[model samples]
Target: MKTAYTAALSMLAGIAVGAVAIEGLHAQSTPKAYVVSEIEVIDQGAQNAYLPKVTELIKSSGGTFLARGGNIFAVEGEAPKRVTIAVYDSFAKAQAARTSPEWKALAPERNKAIKVRSFITEGLPN
Candidate 1:
């Protein structure tokens, strides 16, 4: 009887450990956020100069570019000339990256060169 009781307790402990591991995996697989920007360049020369500075700033803030300067085919409405998407760990991180001082300083040049509409959206879970 004692041996049977010990085996049952061991099984319960194993099940509990497995449940905790699954929870950890689910947390790690939580969806990230993307910072999407649609840009229309008014002055190509100024836009060229502005691009590198903001690119570096985004990298420094732990952002990864998922898409940059890609052609867009809009079926519903007018299409944007250029689109850039940057993925960060979370929505808050994406917001901080855009609002960081380094990025802010480069904003005027970017604004002068291009009209930008930027927003953040939650990414699909892996």
Candidate 2:
């Protein structure tokens, strides 16, 4: 009876340790989300007017800019005039930022001035 009880406790302890290890691994493996925008300035005047407001809105929504208005070279496909990359805490946050009231209010201005192709992608684990 003693041996049986000890064996059961050992098994439970092993399972607990294994569970913790798996959870830790999962946390480490979680990926971040990136919001990428490819923009073409159809009307430079209008785009210049609209950019500052939207840039502030994005910053308020927990977004960090990785790249903005830099040189882009196309390896295979066509490249847009400007490429913007922003990282959010998660996919949900990225979605929320796009749909936020402040961002929505500026949509008309952006649409009038620039052509934008934007998407969210899962980034590799750190």
**Candidate topping TM-score:** 1
lDDT of 2: 0.89
Candidate 2 residue-wise lDDT, 26-97, digit = tens: 766777789999999999899889988888888999899999998899998897899999998778789999
The regions of model 2 sitting more than 4 angstroms off are 1-30
Residue 87 CA error for candidate 2 (Å)?
0.6
Backbone clash count for every predicted candidate, in the order shown: 0, 0
What C-alpha lDDT, on a 0 to 100 scale, does residue 67 get in candidate 1?
Answer: 95
